[model samples]
Target: MSAAPRPADVVIIGAGQAGLAAGYHLRRAGADFVILDAQQVPGGAWQHAWPSLRLFSPAQYSSLPGRMMPIPAGGGYPDAAHVVAYLTDYEQRYRLPIIRPATVRTVRRAGARLAVESSAGTWHARIVVSATGTWWRPFVPHYPGMRDFRGEQVHTAGYRGPEPFHGRRVLVVGGGNSAAQILAELSQVAQTTWATLRPPRLLPDEVDGRALFDLATRRHRATLAGQHPVGAGGIADLGDIVAVAPVREARDRGALKAEPMFSRITTTGVAWADGSAAAFDAILWCTGFRPALAHLAPLRLRGPSGLIGTDGTRALAEPRLHLLGYGDWTGPASATLIGAGRTARQLAGEITAQL
Candidate 1:
């Protein structure tokens, strides 16, 4: 027989950085809550990242409230494992009630209580924080003959490091950081080519909080701060903070060519928007991720887009429902841990006020 069901004041649908940050404040405020993470460990999104991954930023901005990420040697990036370890420690230190392997399948509001159904069972809470996060589902672009390929192909999520493609021709099929970072790293070892629909822009990881985020909170709050200083002679101000090594090298080599975006992905290779096809051994799709929330019903959402879209502190039509760490909707610093903490703290106050 299954154990008895536990009730709580709030049921956070995710236990990643966002939900964990939210829980930190919830616990501090003496709020009764439970964090339900789909994964077995606390490193929500990091678990799916490539093995050789490291924080683009210095470790200083990455650490959470109660714990510190151990500095890696030579001041390089911290790999995905380092993040996993740090988040594991954070959960233990806070004594947060995080239920593991409880991949939430559905959520709803019946009468005044919020109900969450997961692998573990059903949970009832007064409030629900849809922190399943913006990056719940990895997006794999549908292309012709994707399944007909006779070789090994995987999402960037499943990639480990350059060892897999050592001395091989590698084709990275996205323009985002995952595609960029991996492409740059793999280029040093293998013949790597990055395929994108648009001319990709590499962004600087160092986002200035005061100049970018806080500047918008109250003063120029409506506008995103530090969005590439004025007169910055670069593409969308991304070139300033980020140095595009591969693209520059490719530029000098006449190998870098961009289409209007990827149109299709055949098993052999990618087909461009102009109906051109390129063959390859493997293609890494870093298009992006979508949230898997189709199961959650009765929760009215205002998404013309396919997300629980919210501006951190703002409520949906449902007052009890809040969203955290959902891209730039929350705050300018939404993607960063510091921003998540600030947003979660505000949410704690909002929840307290409702209580």
Candidate 2:
């Protein structure tokens, strides 16, 4: 028999940047809440990023609410490990109530409260915060013969670096920043082909995450005002292919060139639109991810585009639920570390008022 469910005024279903931010505000409001994380350790998805991955934003811009990330050795952008350390420290510094190694399975409405069932146990809360970000749900699109392909295929979630791909023929797929960064590295040690729906667009070398966040904020505000967005740049404006040292080297070597996506994948490699084929040892799909919303499936709040309709961060259908750090739809730049804090603060205020 299972143990009796614990009770809380609020239950947050992720302990990453989003959840942590919410916890900061909930605590400040003196609301009773608990944060649950699936990962055994802290740092959220930062713990799983590739070895060389670095934040495009510096420490100041990458921090969560009430705490700044400790600047790294050279006062430059923090790498993956540095980020992990910062997140770990943030949780500790704040003394947030976080339960780890708890994999939430479902969230169901029970009476006037929500029952969050997880491996660790169960929690009943008056309000639920679904903050699980996109890292767990990598989305790889379908292509003909993909099932028949014998070559190794991996999504960016599983890709570490070029060491394992040394001397192999690699096809790096997608046009986003992750694709560009991975392709840039894979090209250095492996014979690589970058395939994209369209050519990749890169931001100016001087523009980094801070600039991108400003542009995104401007665009978001313009949209709200129904004005012609002068800050308009497509998705690529979000720190696309930061001209980092490695990426710059790759660019100079002509490794940044891209090809149109092929029609299908074959046993040996990919087949082109004109029925041409090229052999490859592997294919890396950096095609991005969907929000990790499976645990909230019981709530039935998601609609088209796999998003929960929201007024800001509060679910439209379920007023007691708030989704943080999913993307622009939830709040402007909420998926980013810096932006999550802003959304969390606002959402906490709303929740506090309602409660």
Candidate 3:
């Protein structure tokens, strides 16, 4: 038999940047809260990122609330390992109450409190903050005969490096940063083809995450003030891609060109809508991810669009629940490091007021 549910005033799901930021605030407020993390280690999704991945912003801009991330020794954009080190330090610095390897199974109403069922145990809390990020839920769009493709197929989540595809023909799908970065690296050693639904919009060389975050902040403020914000689309209005060093290098090498998305997959490779086909040894899908809200399914809060309606961070159907770190829908730029910290500050203040 299972033990009785442990109690907390607040329960925050996930231990990534968003959850850590929330925990920092709630701790400062002296709230009785606990963070439940699915990962056994401190670094959340960063620990799983490809080894060569680098942040679009500098270390300082990608920091949590209490402490700024130290610039990497080499002084370029921090890589995945640097981020992992920073996160591990941040967790230890704050001494936040975190339960790891505690994969939450479901969150359901139990009297006045919500019961969080997890691999670790059950926790009953007055408020539940779902800060679970979307890294685990990779999305790969279906194409005709996709299942019939005999070539190796891999998604962004499973990708590690390009060495495996060396000297081979590889097809890369999607036009986002991941697709660009991965294609750039693979182009160094492999013959790569880029596929996109539309032509990619590359931001100016000077534009980066810091500029995008500032724009998002201004737009968020304008929205709060009930004004029609100029440049309301934030990063989308600027461009779809950031020309990081490697990407620019690839562009200079004439390897950054994109082709229209193929219509179907074949046993050997893929066929374009124009009746042309190409053979590839591997197909890398950098499509995207959806919100990781499977644990909240018991609440039935999602609508037909598979999204939970929210006023800021609070769920419309259940006031006791607040979703964080998913994306702009939860809070403007909330998925980013600084964005998550800013949103968590507001969310913790609101939750503190209730307590």
By lDDT, the candidates rank as: 3, 2, 1
What TM-score against the true fold does each predicted structure earn? 0.82, 0.96, 0.98
lDDT of each: 0.69, 0.89, 0.93
The prediction achieving the highest lDDT against the true structure is 3
Residues 1-355, model 2: lDDT tens digits? 8899999999999999999999999999999999999999999998899988878788988999999888899887788999899889999999999998999999999998999999999999999999999999999999999999998999999988789999999999998778888888888789999999987767677777787777777877888798987546645644356676667778888899998899999899998898788999999999999999998888898787678899889999999888999988888889999989988999999989978
Judged by lDDT against the true structure, how good is candidate 2? 0.89
- Model 1 TM-score, all chains together: 0.82
In Å, residue 240's CA in model 1 sits off its true spot by: 9.0
Model 1 Cα lDDT, one tens digit per residue, 1-355 = 8655557788888888888889999899898889888887678888877776656544665666656667866665577888878788888888899888898887787677877888988888888887876455678877777788755676876777778788876677776656666776777777767777668754443442333444334432433463543433323443422333443454455444444555666777667767787777776676777655565556767577655555455555667777777655665465566667777888899898877
- Give residue 279's error in model 3 in angstroms: 0.7
Between candidates 2 and 3, the lDDT winner = 3
**Candidate 1 runs further than 4 Å off:** 1-5, 145-148, 203-220, 223-235, 240-267, 271-277, 300-302, 309-311
Cα lDDT tens digits for candidate 3, 4-46: 9999999999999999999999999999999999998999999
The CA lDDT at 120 in model 2 is 92
Question: Candidate 3, which segments miss by more than 4 Å at Cα?
Answer: none
